[model samples]
Target: MGHADLVARLVEAGGLPGEWRSVFERVPRDAFVPDLVWDDDRRPVHRAREPGRWSGLVHRDAPVVTQLDDGAPDGVGYVSSSASMPSIVALMLDELDVAEGMRVLEIGTGTGWNAALLAARLGDGNVTTVEVDPVLAGLARARLARAGFRPAVVAADGMAGWPGHAPYDRVIATAAVRRVPYAWVAQTRPGGRIVTPFGTAFHNGTLLRLDVRDDGTASGRFGGDVGFMWTRSERTPHGSVEERVLPGHDHTESTTDLHPYEPVSDFDAGFAIGLRVPGMLATVVHDGAPADGRFTVYLMDPGSDSWASWRITPRPRGRYRVRQHGPRALFDELAAAYDWWRRIGRPAHDRFGLTVTPDGRQHLWTDTPDRVLDLVPDPGKERAG
Candidate 1:
């Protein structure tokens, strides 16, 4: 499809607002994207080899993989960077509510497409984007310049943010984070908005819109659903939990009525479970026989040897077999989380909010500040947000 058709579709879908329509049309995505970009299937779609296919993918409302494994050798090791889907970009920008002449700080400069759009909407002088990868940063800077835009592009860790241009009116992060970095809150002006993808170790996240307060606290509700690539410094090593095991671990046998897939099968439930139980990596392993009912859910703690596995049969109504190792009761914790979710009427992501203090203390709340949910309770702090 053509750019007009793509922009039309995006506007129809409520991704691109009327105000951003002209800006989106001006900055062509093709200009910033690399020639050898990866498709959704992780297969390389070269512009030289197939110009038609490359253009189609570029104009479509989809994310284009820009860098793999931080530009490491090997065929698509992992998606280190990407041009976010246009719709998601629009959604994040809408949540940001950036205004004319407002200074914006962008955490990730992936293909510089987002920065270009922001620069178009808020002027090049008002936009500053930081990228940790020097190569990506340099390339993005060149691309923006080629596109007739010159947003300040800094090559440094985005987590630290561009502190030199402190007190921004808005801060937006294209990268996903486990916690809303304190630096972002500190850098943004009071009452300013910070938009980011807040994910847990479970690898799922919701777009969060936080507003900075005068007392060094930033709080906001969750917005749209998203799962962006982790920031460079927070990126975890690739490998299954089973690959790394400790010697001194205890094992216990148990059975529960809850199926292993119950919590994770649904996005809202999984997000709730993740918030309730932090620092957990959950993966489902199919035993090559979903028809025969051989499936297992593995839960492991990244910080410790605590791991739990639940094997479920194909039958819908039955007690599933469970095995847990290490000091933490992984299965039991999940059950509790599920129960809490149920008790709370299975609240949606919008009902949830996160508050981060200057000291990096995060508190998850439901609706009001007083009704805080203690995901990881700190000894000195109270549950009150």
Candidate 2:
């Protein structure tokens, strides 16, 4: 589709305001993207700024990876930055509810494409964005400047949030976070909105919108499914495999109770299990073997020096048997969370909400009984904004 058609489709999709169609039409996506990067399938390709080809990439509904492995040329490791997918960006913007002249603070500047969109909607002076990497931040600043849009581009830890531009009308994070930062709530004005992708280390991402209160607390609903790179500080991989992979005595016995079962994919289920079981690292394993193939979930808790496994055996009838092993009984925790979902009759994503306290505690809430669980942070550790 052409740029005009893409913009029109996005508007018709209803995630972005009608006024944004013009902004999308005006901004050239190729200007902010890198010379070459991986596509969605991890294929190495160059999205060269050659008019027709480049415009095609921009107009596509998918997000193009602008920087892989934190801007590494080899594209090894994980995805660190990108020009966010059009639909996800539109969903986040809708949750942000940014108004004309509203002051906005964006964490994770990435290619500065989202910043440009925000600047176009809220005006340049109303937007302030922070990027942790000096090189990425510099490039984004230059690109935005070249695009004739200037927002306060700061080279600093986004987790701290740019205090100089405090009391923002909206604070949006492009990165995924396991816990909502207190600084974001502290920086947002009363009744202002703070939107970020919130999930456990194990699951994909969910966009959360919380309204900040004067008491430094915030609450709001989970907007939709999202996926983003982990915050820079929480991006480190955990170590010590033996303790997490081996079976232990405390492992819970498997039960026939399927009350907690929620129909989530292996990836999402592993993530949700990891979050529910604090201090435990969860991983999904697929052997690619034939004949009723199986998937296994491994949970490691270094603190307890224990590991556990949940083996899911699929039957011909589309049912699964969850077997548990190891001292920690990680599958039990997962099953418990699944049961929680079942007890609530499998509530929709919008029915779930997140609350953040000034002390950096994240709580997940559901409408049924309104149960809240604290997403406590690691002790003696402080993360950058």
Candidate 3:
């Protein structure tokens, strides 16, 4: 499968607007993709060595990691940058809802494919993209030029935004952010739109589309399942389950009838819990390599050096083992968050919305702006270490 095949698949899936179909078809995703790509295992796959595999991945409807740990030589660590999945790219573009002659500002120009799509839809002169990493920005600029489209590829911090070309008609971020930068809102004109992937440490994230109001504030709701890598400045603290939840650590033992199935795995529950219990990360480790159903769900907060382990066995019969360490009882906090969610009619993610003021404060609400989610952290439950 190649570019045409990918476009056909996207069209078949149905959000490829008539206009965008031509844009997607015209701009070659392969040209924007680098010769060096990383596999799911974080191992580098050079186009020269694995041409077929590289082509397949490039054309596949999945995200392709383009850089790891900011291109550090300390060996492949985490996915620092990637060519976002084509479907998500199309979805975000569709949500962007750009029109001809509309000035657009794009954040996080990873592979330049998204920016190319934007430039193709709106003229090159109307599109401006920002990338924090100078190297990635330069490469993306060259790729965009090679593909016959040259939008202003500014090598600057995307979070700050390319303010020189302010008052954009639309602003979209390819990176996820915990806080929607006021610069983006301030740079966008009244009635403009800002679409971004917004998430907290507890969750990978969902799509956020904010409408910039005349009052210099933007407010919008969560609607899509688009999870992008966090901007460098707002990245969640990183720590492995094994690294944080060690056996030697002091802990308080307890039991909970609450299973990990709903709280940790369910989309709605996890999203709600993320909003309630901020800065928490969960990881699951199975008991046996033979593929046993029994596993342990570990919740960690690297910021506070706190962790909680919830073990589940086949036929649990509602009794699960839970052990928590550090001053903050992560298990208790998560359980409380889950209880709160259940208490309030069990809302879906779409019901959640956020408002960003000019001062850069974010307010999360349920259903409407007035029905705010009480997100203030409890001092006992969320103390800094």
Per-residue lDDT of 1-385 in model 1, one digit per residue for the tens? 7778888899888778888899998988889999989887888899999999899889998899888978986843699989999999988888899889899999999999999999999999999999999999999999999999999999999888889998899999999887777999999999899999877665467888899999999998885679888877666555574574444566888888887565877778888887877666788888886676688888877555578888888666677888898778888988898999999898987898889988889888999766788676211111101
Model 2 TM-score on a 0 to 1 scale: 0.82
Task: Identify the candidate with maximal lDDT.
Answer: 3
Q: Please, what are the lDDT tens digits per residue for candidate 3 over residues 1-385? A: 7899999998998968887899899997899889999888777899999999899889989999999889887853878889999999989988888888899999999999999999888899999999999999999999998888999999898888888998799999999877788999999999999999987777768999999999988998998777889888777656677677787899988888988888888888888888888778888888787267789988888778988899888774778899989978999999999999999988998998988888777888999988876674211222323
Best by TM-score: 3
Q: Say which prediction, candidate 1 or candidate 2, comes out ahead on lDDT.
A: 1
* Backbone clash total, candidate 2: 14
Provide TM-scores for the models. Answer: 0.92, 0.82, 0.95
Give per-residue CA lDDT, model 2, range 39-123, as digits (tens): 5577666555455555566678878777767666664447777788887887788778877878999999988999998888888
lDDT of each: 0.84, 0.71, 0.86
Ranking of candidates on TM-score, top first: 3, 1, 2
Total residue pair clashes for candidate 3: 0
